[model samples]
Target chain A: MDSQITLSVNGTSRSLTVDSRTTLLDALRERLGVTEVKKGCDHGQCGSCTVLLDGRRELACLALAVARDGVEVVTADGLAHDGLHAVQQAFLDHDGYQCGYCTPGQVCSAVGMLEEVKDGHPSHVTTDLEADVELTDDEVRERMSGNLCRCGAYAGILAAVRQAAGA
Target chain B: MRALDYLRPESPAAAVAALVSNPNAKYLGGGTNLVDHLKLGIVSPDELVDISRLPLDDIQEYDDGGGPGLRVGANVRNSDLAAHPVVRSSFPLVARALLSGASGQIRNQATTAGNLLQRTRCVYFQDATTPCNKRVPGSGCSAREGYGRYNAILGASDACVATHPSDLAVALAALDATVVLLGPDGERRLPLAELHRLPGDLPNLDTTLGRSELITGIEIPFSPVAALSTYRKVRDRASYAFALVSVAAAVHLEHGAVRDVRIAWGGVAHKPWRAERAERALVGQQLEPDVIGAAVEEELENAASGDENAYKVTLVRNTTVHTLLQLAEGHR
Candidate 1:
C-alpha cells in the first residue's frame, strides 16, 4: 500500500515512497527530514502542523501524503531562503514566543493569512461581507484561532502580526 | 492506523464505479473529517478513492428546469465558497455559517460535500474505548448518562442523543437546498432536509445515501428571503468552538406583516431541525417579540432534555427570536 510520489518542497522536487496511512506532517518530518512543520495534535484540533500547500494555509496532520502527491508544500523553514522573512523578523522583534513550540506554525499561519486578506477573504467577525477586509485585531485573532500557543503568547503574536501587516 | 490502498479516479462516474467495485472503499474528500476518524481507529476502510482533484470544483449559475439558482460543485472548499461574490450577495447566511464553523486553515481544506457528511462530535464516539451506538451498533451510549452538554434535545431517539455539528447544513436546510448525487445506477437529486436522517432505530446510519453513491454537487434555488438571510451561533467561545445552540433565519415582510419565513436550528437534533411549526405560526403575523416567542415555543413543545443540558431549550428559543427580530429590522 505504499506509493512513490514527488512533492515540490520549498521549490525543490523531492521524491519519496509513503504509506497510504502516513500523514503529510509525518512524511515531511520522518521521511523527507523537513521538520519545520511540528506535530502537536495528530488530530486536526491543534494547528501546529500548519503548512502552505500551493500557497494556501492547510493543516498537514489532516492530509494524506499519497493524496497530496505533486503538491507544492512550503514549510516554515522554506519561508526564508536568504534572509529572515518579514513575519519571522517581526515575531522576533515583538517577542512572540515563550518556549517556541508553536512559533513555526504561528509564522506560517501569519504568512498565509496575509495572503488571504489580500485576496479579500472574510472571517467570522467580518461585519460587511461585500467590502474588502482589513486586518483588524479581531480579524487576525479570528483567522489565527486554529493555531494555539499553550504558553499564552497571543498578545505578542498579535502585535507581531499587526507589525508585519503594516496595520 | 491501518494500511489501505489509494485510488484517484479521473471522473465522477469512474469514482462511483470504483466504490461499487469495493464494498469497503470510501470516497475521500479534503480529508479533514475522515482522516481524523481513520487516526482514531473508528473506521477501517480498506481503500480510499481520493476524489479531491476531480473536476467538481466550480461554482456556477445553472437552470435545472426548476428555476435559476447556483450549482456548487462538491469539491469547492469552505473558505472559497464563503468568499464567492454570488454567495455573499445572494446567500449571506451560507457565507456566515461557513465562517462560523471552523478555523481558517481547516476551512481551506474542508470541502462542501465533506462538511455535509461529517460525523457528530460526540465524545463517546471519538473515544474507541467507550461504548457508542453510532460507532458500534447495539453498544450502549455513554453520553446518555455521562456529561451530556452537547446532547440533542429534539428528534432524538433513546439509542442516540448526539447533535449534528455542521452550521452550513443548518443554513442550507433553511434555504431549501437540493443535493445531487451520482451512483452506479445513475444521477439523482435529494432534498437537503431529506438527506440527513433522524436517529430512530438505526443510530449508525447518518444519511439516506446508497452505499455506492457519491455527491456531485448541490443546487441552491434563488429566493428573496434567502438573499437577505443571516446565521447566529451561540457557542462556548466567540470563535473556534461548536455551537451550543444556533439559529438560521430568513424573513420576507409584506405590508409590515410576515409574508414568508424560513428557519432551522443546529446543535439540537441528529439532523438540522427545520422549524416548520414556527414558520407556520409566524405567517401573516406581526414581527413582535411576543409573537416570535410564541412561535418558537410551539416548535419546542416536544423538546426533551436531561439535567446537564436543560439550558439549551431556553437558549435555542432566545437565539431564534433574536435572530428573527434582527432580520425583521433589516427588512424595515
Candidate 2:
C-alpha cells in the first residue's frame, strides 16, 4: 500500500502520494516530473542524484520519498526562476559540463559546498583549520569529486566553481 | 527493489518500537548503506524505520562529567561530525579519516551509525550473481581466490574475505569509543573496538547488533593524545575513493616517551583492525620511525595476503609508518 508524503519543493509545498520504496530521485524525476534532479547510478556511488535537503546537499537516490515528510527539497530546476544561480551561471560560462547529465547535481553540491565554506566548515584538505580557506582548484576538485562527469570536464567544473566563488 | 512501508520515527524509542513491532523492519539513517542494499536485493525489509528524525545528532566530550572525551550521535552526519568543534579539536583522527575516504557530497549525507553498519564493497556481494558468504550464508566466497583485490587479510576464513570500507570506523576503533544501542529494554553500550567481529564461520553476522536494536550513538572516552592524532589513506583515486590501506594513529608524548598510543587500520580486516598489539609496543617507548614501523609491522606479520592484494602489505606498512610519524611530529 502506498502512503501520503508531504514535501516542500522550492517555495511550494505539496502532499505527494508515493510508495515507501520510492527514492527521492524517483519522486522528483518520475512522479513530480522534475527532470533536473538526475539519476545516474541510483546509488550513493554517484552524486548525480544530489539535491538540496534543508540547504544541505544529499543523495536523492539514497533518500526515501515517504520518510521525508516535512523536509524541504530543492532541485536544480527549482534553484533558479529566470536565468541561473551564480554557480550555475559560472558552470555554463566555464563549460563545466559537456553532456550536462551531472551538472545539476554538481551545481547543487557546489551550493552546499560553498555554504560549508561560508560557515567556516573545515575540510580534510584544510591544513590550517583556523585560517581562511581559499576555494582553489584543489579545494573545488576535492569538494566536487562526488559529481562525476563522464565527459571528464573536471578542469572546467573546477574553474566554474572557482570563478563562482570569486576567484 | 520492491516497495515497502516507511516511517520516520520521532525518537530512538519510537524507532526501537517500530523494529520490535515489525519483524521485517530496518532502521534507516543516512540511506547510503541500506538504500544501496535495497537496490542490490541483498536485503528486502518490509518496513524502514527512519531514524533520521530522532534526536541523535550530537558530538560531545564528557570531560566535565569525567567520562570519555567524545560522544557521537547515530544520526550525526559524517560531515557535521567531522567538522564539529569537538571532533576537530579533540578527534582529528576521525575528521581526517572521514574527509579522506568519501567525497564531500557523500560525507555530508553518510551518518556515523550508518557508516559503522555499512557492509563490505566486495564485488561479489554487489554483483549478487556469484556465491558469497556475506550475501548468502554458506554460499562459498568467490573472493577467496578470485579477484580478491580488496579482500580481508587479517580476519578471513573459507567463508568470506570482504573488508569493511568505512575509513571513519577505523578512526573510531583507534579512539576506543563506545557505541550506545537502543532496544526494548533501554540502552546498552559496547566498545567500538568490540562492535565488529572477525568473519570466522559466520560471515553474515558482522556485529552483535540485533534486528530490533538501533545504534543510538557512540561515546568516546577522553584521551590527552586526541589532539595529536592523524589519519592517512592510500587509494587509487585522489578523492571519492575507497582505501587500499588506511591508518589512524594517535599518540601522547611525555618527556620523549610515548605515554599512550592508538592505531587502527581499514581495508585490512573484516572489521577495522584495532592494532592494540602494535599500540602496546608504542606505550612508554620513544616515537622513532624504526620502532613505530617495527611495532606496526608486528601486528601485520601474520596477515595472510592473497596474490592479488599482496601490495596491501607494503601499502599498510607505508601508511602506518607515515601516520605514526605525523602524530609524533605534531607533539614537537
Candidate 3:
C-alpha cells in the first residue's frame, strides 16, 4: 500500500505518497526530482547514492523512504548557502571530478566526513582517539573510503578535502 | 523486488507479536544487507517489520562485580558500537572487527542484529536460477564443486560450503558473549557460540534462532584480559571488503607465561571458528613463537579445504600466530 509521508529534504518540506519498497534514492530521484543523488548500484555497495541523514552519512540505496519519514535529509543541493559551499567550491577549484558522475556523492560524503571530525568521531586510521582527528591525506582517504571514484580523481579529491579543511 | 507491506512497531513486544502473527515476515534493521537481497530477488518476505525505531539502541555497562561488561542493544548502529568508549577500551577486538567489516556509509546504517544475521556472499546463492541449498533446500549446492574460493574450510558439509560473513561475530565469540533473544514465549539467552550452526543436513537454517524469536541485544562478559585483545583481518582490499581469513585474539600473561587466551576466526568456517585447542595450548605455556605455531597447527589439524581455498589454511595459521604474538608483545 502507498502511504503519504512528509519529509524535510534540503530544508524544504514536501509530502508525497510512495510504495513501501521505494528507497530513499528512488524517492529523491523519481519523486522529488533530486537527480544529484545518483543510483550507481542501488544496493549500497556503491557510494553514488550517498546522502546526509540528520547530518550523518548514510547510503540512500538501502534506506527506505517510509522508514526515514520526518528525518532531516540534506543532499548536495542543500550544501550551498549563497553560492557553492566551501567543499563544492574546493572540489571545483581542485578539479576533484572528471566525468562528474560521482561528484555529488563525493561532495556530500566529504561534508559528512568533516562533520564527523568536528564531532570527534574516530576513523580506522585514527591512531590516538584521545586527540583531535587531523585532516591528513591518509585520514581523509580512510574516512572517504566508502565513496569510490572510478575515474581515478582521488588525488584531486584528496587535495580538495585538504584545502577545504584549511590544513 | 516484490511489493511488500512495511510495519514500524513502536515497542519490542509489538514487534514480536507482528512477527509471530505473520509467518512470511522478516525483521528489518539498517537494511544494508536485507534490502540488497530483496532487490536481487533472493528473498521475498511478504512483510518487513522495521525495528529501527525501537528503544534498543543504547550501549550500557553491565558491571556485575566481576568486572566491567557491555550489553549492546540490537538496534545499535555498527558505527556507534565501534566508536563507543566502552567497546573501544574494554573490547578493542570488537571495535576493530566492526571497523574492518564495512565502509563508513554502510556502518552508519547497519545494526548489530542485522550484522549477525547477514547472509554469505556466495555467487551461487545470489543467483536465484542456480542450485543453492542455502537459498532453497533440496537444491544441490553448486559452490561445493564449482567456484569455492570463498567457501568454508572448516565445519563444511557436502550439502553446503558457504562461510558466514560477519567479522563482529568472530570478535564476540572470542569475548564469550551471550545473545539475548525475545520470543513469543519469553526472554532467553544463548551463548554466541551456539547461535550459529554448521551447514549439516539442513543447509537452509543458518542460525538456531526460532522463527518467532527476535534478537534483543548481545551481552559481553567483563574480562580484564579482553582489554588487550585485537582483531586482524586479511582481505582483498583495505576497506569495504569481506575477509579471506580473520582472527580475533585476546591474551593475558603473568611472569612471561600465558595466563589466559581466547581466539576465534572468521571467513574460514560456517560459523566463527573458535580456536579452543590453540587456547588450551597457550593457557600454561610461555608466549613463544614455536608454542603459538604448534598450537595453531593442532587447531587446523581437522580443517578440510577444497582446491581453490587451500591457501586459507596457511593464512589462518599466519594470522593466528601474528595476532597472538602482537597481544603478547602488548603485555611485555
Winning candidate number (DockQ): 1
Per-residue alpha-carbon lDDT of candidate 1 for residues B55-92, written as tens digits (9 for 90 to 100): 99999999867998999999999999999999998999
Per-residue error (Å), model 2, residue A69? 1.9
The TM-score measured for candidate 1 stands at 0.99
In model 1, what is the error at residue B179, expressed in angstroms?
0.2
Model 2, residue B170: what's the lDDT? 93
- Sort all candidates by DockQ, best to worst: 1, 3, 2
What's the true lDDT of residue B270 in model 2? 91
How close to the true structure is residue A34 of candidate 3, measured as C-alpha lDDT?
89
lDDT of 1 by residue, A39-58 (tens): 99889887899999999999
Q: What does fnat come to for each candidate? A: 0.93, 0.74, 0.65
Please write out the lDDT profile of model 2 over residues B169-251, one tens digit for every residue.
89989887889998899988888888998998999988878778889888877678777888888889888878888888888
DockQ-superior candidate, 1 or 2: 1
Residue pairs in collision within model 1: none
In the range B31-95, model 3's lDDT, one tens digit per residue, is: 99988898889999999999999999989988776456789999999989988887877888888
TM match of model 2 to true structure: 0.96
> Which structure is stronger by TM-score: 2 or 3?
3
Whichever of 1 and 3 has more TM-score, that candidate is: 1
Ranking by lDDT: 1, 3, 2
**lDDT on C-alpha atoms for all candidate structures:** 0.94, 0.84, 0.89
Superior candidate under lDDT, 2 versus 3: 3
Candidate 2 off by > 4 Å: B63-68
| Candidate 1 C-alpha error for residue A9, in Å | 0.8
